[model samples]
Target chain A: MGAEFVQFSLTPVLIGVLSAIACALPGNFLILRRQALIGDAISHVVLPGIVVAFLLTGMISAVPMLLGAAGAALVAVVLIEAVKRLGNIEPGAAMGAIFTSMFAAGVLILEQTDTSSVHLDVEHALMGNLESLVWLRAEGWHSLLDPSMLATLPGELSRIAAVCAFVVVATLMFWRWLKIATFDEGFAQALGIPSTALGLGLVVVAAIAAVAAFDAVGSIIVIAMFICPPAAARLMTNRLGHQVVWSAVFATLSAVLGYVLAGYGPFWFGFEGAVSAAGMIATVSGIILAGACVFGPHRSRVGVAQQEAR
Target chain B: MSRMAQPTIATDHGHSIDPARAPRDTALAIHGLTVSYGEKPAVFSVDAAFKAKGMSAIVGPNGAGKSTLLKAALGVIPRLSGEVYVFGETIRDARARVAYVPQSASVDWDFPTTVMDVVQMGLYRKVGLLGRLSGPVRAQARECLDRVGMADFANRQIGQLSGGQQQRVFLARALAQDADLYLLDEPFAGVDAATERAIIGVLKSLKDEGKAVVAVHHDLATVRDYFDHVFLINVRRIAEGPVETTFTTEHLQATYGGRLAATHLDELAVADGAR
Candidate 1:
């Protein structure tokens, strides 16, 4: 069992955890600012950005993918703004309209470009192929220590780790500003803080996170960690710093537990094979959110009404 | 009132404010201000000037653009055409010296923030971006909260507070700003008698220190008792001067567009007794 784990499970689990932390670190701010849905939009919108970049460059590289993702997110923002201004509608309506259209644009671009020669398709875009990421070329766990296993690691794992590192550094460096801006934008503006630019910077970072995580876990975990863990953490605490920590814990828990259940739970159900680990991880996070809603220390709707009655 | 009266001068910006006093004394000046939605104007040609040493209330009926006038001046909303000057400089140039307290209803009380966190934001400009909150900044924030009787609730989540307590927290935040001029939207709305008294005392102290206090007020009975000056607004400036003179029954009727709602004298007595 230990040998099999070392051979087949190590890299996939690592990828899942890295992407979860990467997405959830910035997810706290998105939930705080009530812009969580923007992540879902960006995750879908990056499709066309990646496809177009592939067509133009004729090569698949990390830098162009990052740029394409960021550019598509910018277009989504502009389209959302246009809908908000011209239609005189609420923000939720604008986001819904723009996200769908941009995602459809991505599909059309991929179809027209005919890049099927590569191992890329729409199905693999929405739901990632986590089982394929492997560093099992090593003979044993001892080989993982050698320079060969370390040097020949999967690019997906390295890409996610770099993105995760950037997220951690950027979040820590600008922690105070992000907190203030998320809590009260008007107050931030009155104090001469460049809130607009800061907001844009956050969205760009979120785009980068979504883009990087898309390949390993696909869009499911990206959209889930963007909103679910932060929201669940919000139900657990009243402080922003604590909320961030709690959200990371929840995301990591989802990744780890989901991997275990996906690999082993089918036997309990009388099946011999494992399931989709990425989807299972996203499902675990959803279950955690539901658990927080019922059992967290914070007052729920029923709790508030009971207090009023007392 | 006559000592400060001057002809309404139309500047090139089309503002019809009274520029008679020394330019240094005016606290806020709005020139040729017009805000429109599509083709309809919400506020049209609003030109009024406030002084630095008095409590001025923008009084008008519901939908009379009382809040609109203040919001437009602060540039919180879009202004199709106009200039807003604070201390003889454009609002953009004098932003740090000015503070605004939006309506309580506009805020999300359920937001996960402590009273101290909210108050500390007022001093963030002083700390600038990337600066940490030092001991002195936190101390000053506590002092502001103490002034409004919310010092005990510094660490308390804002969502758990009562409506009146929430309003007081916002006031403490504005106090922490320590700005030379303050614009408040309905500070008295939804607040209890004690919070109202505390707020009025704070505003009075601001006036005594020669700072400008422009507020959106609704209770007609307390107009004379609470404010030194009044601006009767109804999509445009109907009248502007000391509350004793500009708050006449004639001006009130015109500003309300003859659709006066019935209010009892007991509310006026409450406003008086609270003070």
Candidate 2:
């Protein structure tokens, strides 16, 4: 019975953790570069890409969704760049103008296309149904090693894992270039480091993470993890490495705690079923950020201690 | 007609450089360098060159394109038309040997990075991809920090440092590069007097080591004392030569234009005269 419980509940939890870590990994760079909104923009714009891919392929696989989302993200980025360049406007204005149009276009695509046949729907895209993914094909923990159980393992977990691994390897491998370019771009350029290439690589990584999170969680959860954990971690530590580590911890905690609260909290309140797990996770991360902003080690204490001194 | 490039009559002194002294002796060369901002020109046909060794100050009043000239010459900004040669070669070849410290205001100080992290950036090209800061490379970074007296603050986040300290840390980062030529934009701006002195000391040391140093300096008062060579700029080269000979009252008048007589500009002229 214990083994069955572990086998039954592990997939959803693993999916949540993997998605959170993936979102948080790239979130650090986005926050550091002050391009946090780009993450939000990418997450929103990817909706149309997924819907379009569904229309074209007539199936909801990982590759097509990722490809469509990546394609849309690339277009969004290119349009943002073009808007900034041709109009000579700030990146913020360009991001707003382009991303909104892409998101609206996505909604239009969803309305026009017969998307009822696809397993994914607008609601699932917004705040994924994590509860529906916990159906274990095997009865015991031994099923993890069983070929049939392994084959039937929840697809979302492995997809999130692949994207998470890519984020980790890329972050570690290109860490030096990212650090230099982010802190002092002119110096990095003068040193002949490919700052422009590094910047684009970061954007692509963010898009990949957004797409990965979109399946098990949603764009809302993706945006929250992309900005909140990194931002909260920023307020908590002076060192960037520590900030990244803290961000990962905060993101994982929000996912774990949020999933449990979402699955079980309604029972205590006498409500039927439960709330959206993605929504709950985002809310928890938001709360964690607020707490950090007010009580984190590097933040607020300076002002409070000064008042005491006076 | 003065824009004419004569092989023999190099503008080193009062119109006589030995013909045998090749143009290769020139550390940096900017020929017909012009920078435009849309319809208007910021710096026009600005021609100046620095020798292989010694400290030269690019001196001018506000809006004189002193910073613009550096940017255009280094290809940091788009030039309307210009050719910059470093050590008789293009900037691309001499990139690894050149270090630039932009105006301190250009940097975002609140960036989450340590002083050591910034210093390590200087070695990016030398280390290349997949190279870690292990053994002697780490020691080199420390030595560079020690030179700027920012060794103790190596682990400290850069945002917490003072303006002068930040400037010193920038200098340390450039020092870690161990480059042959240095271009600095107002390193002394808003720095404490001690920092100014220390920065001047470092510039002189670099000069002593036969490394070319060019700084965009605002204070004309210390031109003769601090720099061996000076380029008096106001959209164009007003004058360029040994500070004692070329930095005259007329050049200051030309650089400042109408702002010379009515303001404290005359004080800088008088200070140089007293020196």
Candidate 3:
């Protein structure tokens, strides 16, 4: 049982947790800034980005895919602003229109192109093949110490780990700036924070996180992790620092619990096949958010009626 | 009510300040400042100078470009044409010497932040990136918050505060900046009387400390009581000088135009006469 767990579940679970943390770190700021949907927009447009990257590079390498998705996200942000100004539409509407259209273009391109030869498809993009990334050479926990065996682990795990470390460092280095800008942009600007550039940098970071995580656990987990854990953590605490920490905890919890349930719960129910780990992780995050809404300490406004009376 | 009756330098067409008083003591000066949106000009060729150690008010009616003038002068918004100087130098060179307070409604009040956190942001430039908040720095922030009567609410989330308290918190943040020239937009708008008094008291103290205070003021009744100098504008600079001289009925009429009812104008004119 331990060997099977190490071989099949360990790498995917680690990847899932890392991906969740990567997306949720930026998600806290996005949620506070009321730009949570930016994650949804970026994730949706990533399909087209990767498709374009595949076509241009004639390969499915990680670096080219990441660059392509980041470029697409930048284009989407500019296009959304252009549409909002030129078409005189609200931001949400502009975002919805652009992302959906871009996603549709991605689907059309996917259909027109001959991608059957590769592991690229709409289903695979939406729901990653996490289960297939098994550590075949591992012979229990001892394999972790063996460098040769460790090198045999799935590349997705290391990619996500690197991205997760990058996101964590970036978050810590700019923690004060992000907090100030998210709370009061004008005040931040007055203090020489370069608030507009910082705001764009946040979106770019969020896009990078989404693209990296999506490569591992697919878009379902990416979008869910980007919003749910942060939102739940927001309901748990009044302080930004506490909320960010809570979000990381919630994200880690969701990934581990969801992966275990998806992989083993079906057998417990006497079923034959396992469920999709990506979908299950997203569902677990949603459940956590729902629970926070019901019972979190700071779930509701402090004093709406009293305020109105005053 | 004569524009020429003022003792210091004053201009009719708004530009061309006396070159003698042009340097050193001027807190902020705008030359031929114009800002337009699409086709219509919001602020047109405005030229004005605010001096140090004085409390100045920018007064105008709605849509009068009062806010725009402050924003353009501070380089917060792009200006079509203008030169803005802070203490005789470009704002970039004197950035640390200047501080600004936007309207209370400018930021999302429900943001997850405490009063102390917001105040500490004022010290961000000094703290630098990655620097820890030393005890002295935290003490300075606490002192600023205490000035605005928000010391006890340091850990309280901003959304829990009233409109007045929120304004006070913003004032505390500006105070933490410890700036030489403070620019505020509608500091008194929608604030409680206690908060208003507390804010004015702080502004007065800042003035006494030899710092300059510039605000886009809406309440004309308090202009005489609160500010020593007033700049009246309606897209263009109508008049600007001491409150006793520049803030007159004629200038108010020119600034508000038909927006001020005849009866209200009479009341204001009567008030002016009484003063």
What is candidate 1's lDDT per residue for B1-275, written digit by digit as tens? 67456656554556454544326468888887898766778789989899877899998878878887887787766799987878766666677888878888876677777889888878866787678789998899999999999999999877777778888888898988899899999999999999999999999998898899999999887887889888988888899997655666566666776477425333332233232
DockQ of 1: 0.36
| Tens digits of lDDT, candidate 1, A34-153 | 888888888888888878778888877767876887788889988887889998988888988888887898888888776788866787777788878877676678867888778777
After superposition, candidate 2 runs with Cα above 4 Å error: A1-8, A300-310, B1-23, B36-39, B262-266, B270-275
Query: In order, what DockQ does each candidate have?
Result: 0.36, 0.38, 0.48
lDDT of 2 by residue, A1-310 (tens): 4665556567777788888889898889887888989999999999999888888898888789889988999999999999998888999999999888998998888988787776676788788877666746767777778787788887888789999999999999998888888887777777777788899999999999898888778888999999989999988887778889999999999999898889789997999898888899999999999999888987753454355447
Sort by DockQ, top down from the best: 3, 2, 1
TM-score of chain A of each: 0.92, 0.94, 0.95
Model 1 alpha-carbon miss at residue B195, Å: 1.3
lDDT of every model, 2 decimals: 0.82, 0.84, 0.88
> B-chain TM-score, every candidate?
0.87, 0.88, 0.89
Better of 2 and 3 by lDDT: 3
Model 1 lDDT, full chain set: 0.82
Interface RMSD of each: 2.8, 3.5, 2.3
| lDDT for position B14 in model 1 | 62
